[model samples]
Target chain A: MGDNLISVNNVSVNFDYQENFISKKQKIHAVNNINIKIKKGSFFGLVGESGSGKTTLGRAILGANKISSGNVIFHDDERDYELTNMNKQDLKEYRKKAQLIFQDPYAALSPRMTVRDIIAEPLEVMKITNSRQETDERVRDIAAKCRLNIEHLRRFPHAFSGGQRQRISIARALVSNPKFIVADESVAALDVSIQADILNLLKQLQTELNLTYLFISHDLSVVAHVCDVVAVMYLGHIVEMGPSRELFKNPKHSYTKALLSSIPSIDPEKRSEAIELKGEIPSALNPPPGCVFRTRCPNPGVDCKGGEITMGLTEVEPGHWVDQCCVL
Target chain B: MSHLLEVKNLDVKFDTDEGRITAVENISLTVDQGEVLGIVGESGSGKSVTAKSIMKLNPGNTSYNEDAEIILDNENVLQFTSKQDLKKIRGGKVSMIFQEPMASFAPAIKIGAQMVEQLLIHKNINKDEAKSISINMLKRVGIADAEKRFNQYAFELSGGMRQRAMIAMALSTMPKLLLADEPTTALDVTIQAQVINLIKDIIKEYQMGVIFITHDLGVIAQVADHVAVMYLGSVVEKGPVNEILKNPKHPYTKGLLQALPDINNLDAPLSPIPGNIPSPLDRPTGCVFRTRCPHHNPEGKDGKIEMKLIEVESGHWVDQCGIQCGQNG
Candidate 1:
């Protein structure tokens, strides 16, 4: 009853750009030494800017990206599989347990395929269920769970709006009855009104299925509404990890505070000056040494320059962990 | 004094394959010389179309009804049919910034070149003067290393930088009016805020009439002096920002304001408007929002939708037949 669904222990993914026969390679640390724990039935959020390597961390957990080092273990009620060292057969089985819900619903989905086929593709490819009737029933069940109209199952992706298409994407991801799902910017593309509808649906599905989610998005407000716990990433390193409310209320990192301040207030008279970041997000290929955020940090000190950026989740308060300033 | 820009009883139609579709209808608003006017609506609400119409930027198939009158600086821009007049209106006086920065900027051309070109086109400035003006504009938008970045192409810069570059280019001409259409929707929240503040600053510095078009209520609340809440291409509610935000009159506007996630109040769930934006083909006969209006009757008597825009309070307007608004108020 007190088991963890997924455990990412200091996992890092590095993409090596090697040239000709000389083997002069450059390593781009996309996800650098990230440690996160997803509870059996919890919505965990991973938030950062575009080049923060949040998406890479999600992919590392999902086994889409090659884990350069460290352990990523998936512990179910039944058994625990070491994700980093899984063989072909074991990895294939693990694929069924952990599925990905892509961000761009339009691009992720095939225009040629009907909604039914899109949903049924997973079941058929995985051989989870035999026969067309079985596939049809399974597709319908998941589609209904995702609040998709069964009548529209036969329609093409073009016929549906952005929100409806996202629902279809969700249905396809959950058709195989996966225990864990990574929804990367799932509602970012949708309109504000539609974003709420999708968020409601996701919450409902999480409770109904008792599913674990690794919701990745740059939208802090949306993350606040749904996620139980959140990890703030900056240039491949997670600077802060804590409960959503705690993080929102008292952000430890300077970047997190700046990000929080940037959110526009709905009240007309209550407008505050947004904390403006000076320089753009540095390139991942040629990342700055020492603290990855030192370039953009408003309160950067001498320690931020030479000190190596590491993810040490120090207990800021009860159940709240934040990476402290190592230089001091 | 009269407003800088005045749009009254505006109705724009496009001849599509289906039929003549009314994109915008009965939108009446004004923007003072130094005031920022926000026109907000969801997709298919004709927010962008309305802004484009001010510059006479509508497509060839667009059929502007006779009832509409778009007056810019006491001159009727709705009747601008010739290319020369439209050009003068577009870049010379009323400059625009589009949503997709990459799509708007040329892929091969340097950011500096494009800005200088835009400046030269409208102002007939010398090459050296244009270059200096472009660099200054870039600096104004908070672009670090403006001199260096001016040489870089659009793709070389990040999304936020590209948008800043776009704004710098648009403002370089020193246009009287800035028509920004969903300018910051594509950027991150942090970037969006930066752009919004930059726009606000520029609007104030230039004392220019700005019409900011967006789907976000929060943004409009922050930047706009007066906001016109649009639904199905018509101005449902038009008033001061405070009035619109604190006490929204229109059902569509109320839905939009409520839909925004209130960070201050965490207890209340985001109340997104139920049902999708109605298709242009299936637009209602009477009120455009009647089909999706939660308050209006779906199955009314006499096959006529009775819901019409009514001034509910001293400066607030709303639909007449609000079924679910009493509880909301």
Candidate 2:
């Protein structure tokens, strides 16, 4: 196996937003110059708030979102595939190697389809198995791994609860034997106990299948528990990136620190004097120059307002990277 | 000796197409002026139902038991039949901030106009006075461009701004009680923090009794002075926030605390409560939580154990689930 499963180098994805014929066209910088390398079988987390572009970045790596600049490289045992420059057939082949688990289980699955049909659909579309018997076998295998029994395969999506429905969603994603998966807030909709159950299931599957995950979520606590490497994104830019333990222990960027402090704790003493960022996150359409977080940064220097920091990361510690402007 | 709000044996049932279903059962809690009582629970726990019952905001299909009482400032809210009395309770004496700000707001009306209309109806104030008061409230909630926002519709504001505006409108009435039902659950973490801080400051400034309802225990620790942990429409555990968090007596409470992925201790495997919460129709006989409770004693006390709250400590109360009652009290 290669050292890195996926290498995203200086990739940026921007969307053209034009409300109507009367309105002026504007560029929404969804993923701007992000650089990340996911080691084989590592759980890499993309953490951010709403409008932080974490999901956009995840979709870009999954070859779903159109990239505006740079490239994405997917490394396998045989060869490396340039995801950004794939033809139709190559793209279809790449789709089988990678998959996405949606956030809302209720909306992801079709009500008309039984659990077996939902799981088998992925294999059928991906052309993984030949006949109905083979498809059924693959469906049952993945469902059992996801903790869904053979009896559950006959029932429609409405018959299952939120957590069970999510298990069905996961089984569908894994049925194609994907090497990598992008779980986009997969457990965000479930209750706490169910959320934990799903998280544990994900971890167990990862080890069993030797899977690499790009776990995108707004919750830092959940990310802390599961992810081996973490990247903190804000307003289309990655503010901090490093090993989860190191980054959580010693966060360098101001935005990273503020985001960490925002996680509410069960102990009242822990939340006291937390770095309460001023104002809401700025829109990606017209983010503040220099540092995007300058508007809400707790301590912005005089140069921060107008002076744009060089658009790249500086390794502050052994394996930690922070935006240069935020290091000050 | 009178409390700001006291809910005595609040039993709520809804007449559905099938039959009458118990939505909330024998739930009781009190909130004094300048105090915050947090109601923590997952879905089907009926925390929101308990909160809505205070303002009697549930749908027409709902029916309260004869012994159920919702007393607000010594007035029985259940018996309030007159429109004026109902008006006096809603927005006059009690205000509610919902999880979704857009749902509470009138989409067609200007933000300022709705605030002014509520003030005009409840406060016997002039239009000019109401407008100024509404603008002041908008400014107090830290919404920039207060005048511009006042003219804009609900769709114009961002999620955070909409929540702040809702909070401003809810507090502008200067009510004695505030029922915040998952007010920050929809917002992002940073926005959630800002809204939480705003609520804390508003509580101190206005001294409004707040009933904060959410599934997150972390939020409960931040905003609640006292907390009630609910499970399947019953308060499983009730105590001071510190005691409940640090040393929970109920198995459900302990399970909930352990289920949350502790940021400090990342290595410990998450122990989710064993199984899915039982469907309401198939509610467990003895204790509602017994189906999934790790400490479930299969042999119940004669196949019937009436749910009762046992005073375990000076202030703390836990449900008399035979397993925990004797050991705790």
Candidate 3:
């Protein structure tokens, strides 16, 4: 991958328990060992249901989470840093190079701050600008790029609709001029018609800024439409990874098949035989032996009852990889 | 043919800090026995308000116009004046399931206790009979270990299991109609698919009418026999599901179809609607969708909002447009 921007190699994030009296000290494996590469300027997608650890992986790459092991390397030209071991000054520099856009526009923005202040907060906190005049000029330039009316900056987020508030969020994320950005479900709360408008805006901005995005969402349809490369996650693991078109057309894993079948089709006459997996998702605290999917796999047999899981990522075809544990 | 439920010129209004606002206007739809009617619209489309109207579950500020008569079978639900009469019609004649299962259920109360209470209040049933019937209903909905789960609280169940418990409680009384308001929007896609199938099977077995409201058109295609597309506060179009999906005549409906992510056509880009919905207070005159309609072009510098509803085709309709179709005659 000549244009690889983000290199995540065997990174794992675990949340520590602080309670004093629990007999079995517990640690939540929010994100297990994961390795992937995001090409420069590509709209890469990370998709999974809640509690699947997709969000944690995105945060770990951004240096937002405490990584327990492995390293996340951000490469642009020859300037690559080991994110897990960065010092205070180096971490500050890394933070300026990468930023996050939260899922909830309403809660992410401050109610008391004006739009202008909200966009300028990141610059002020990072101490990137020396004077107020310089800060205002930078905010105005990014606001125009995001298609926000400069006059709207005088108002608060409560005065805007869901779509408008999202625009302000985009301006905040882009004002830092970061090389890599993580947009976490930025348009999931907006209407369907508005969702398209926001998506178009993001695509246009990506080209203008020469930015790489890690778009995280559970809506596979949206992912299929927007992302260049897609990764599927289940219970803190990526079960399948491939180009968007390839995976949608010929999904190799049974879990992928079930997820694809779940998307509602607009054509009433077209109905796929949906795979109904009985029983709830097992707790991550105590995962099952062998493959995590073996409990729900319809093809589970005597071969699936052991404690050993097939390791390594096997390439089924060009640019497509499925975990070895998948029976295919 | 007699319809299972009918709303005649229904209008619902809410008094807010700004002013009195109309949420649903002149809406009329009929659900035949054993048929599924889908009300499709995004937020602020008043899909849920219309469903709530059938059960008279709107807020105190909501006032139904005098012409509004929710006819269940033949009796007007609004005419049920006394508490006893309203009670007989509410859970006995029709039952409703909501979007959030946790919010709908009492967290402190045991699942079995709540079901038994509903049965006792509606019908002249004893505790022993209600408990047995509740357990049987839970089993029918495919809940394993019904006896053990019956004693558990709503918080003990998972998202999918909680929804099943809600369905069991709602259907135990065997109402003639079921009103589901975005029932599967909160669940995961796979879990959502299972719930959709469960509702479809139950409707078939009982032969009861259903009013399914959701923003997802894909889910509607799988379950609905008839589909009604709603804009701001009114029904833009209603027809057979296949006809509307294949050949959408209304501009708003066309935008919805184009906005959807086509799982079959993975290569095509999604063309989302360009603008947000106008607030009800600032609604454009004539056609409600003209502000967002790409075909509506202002001829001069005036650039005023277009306000005319035009009938473009038989059994299909659209607002006045700047685009010339050559079939205006």
Which one wins on lDDT? Answer: 2
lDDT of 3 by residue, B49-76 (tens): 9988887878888888998888998999
- Residue runs of model 1 more than 4 Å from their true location after superposition: A18-24, A305-311, A326-328, B296-308, B322-329
Name the lDDT value of residue A15 in candidate 3.
Answer: 83
C-alpha DockQ for predicted model 2: 0.78
- Lowest summed-lDDT stretch of 10 residues in model 2 chain A? A303-312
For candidate 1, the per-residue lDDT at B44 reads 78
Q: Write the per-residue lDDT of candidate 2 for residues A30-117, one digit (tens) a residue.
A: 8899999999999999999999999999999988999899899999888888987789998888899999999999999999998899
lDDT of 1 by residue, A1-328 (tens): 2568998898989998876768778888898888878988899999998888988889989899889999899997778889878899988889999999999988988999999999999999999998999999999999989888888899999999888999999999898888999999998888888888898898889999878999999988888888999999888988888889988988888888889888877778878667887767887888887777778877777776555654455787877777776323
Task: Report candidate 2's fraction of native contacts.
Answer: 0.76
Interface RMSD of 2: 1.1
Global local distance difference test of model 3: 0.84
TM-score of each predicted structure versus truth:
0.95, 0.98, 0.94
Docking class of 2: medium
**Residue A20, candidate 2: C-alpha displacement in angstroms:** 3.3
For candidate 2, give the lDDT.
Answer: 0.89
DockQ values per model: 0.66, 0.78, 0.72
Best by TM-score: 2
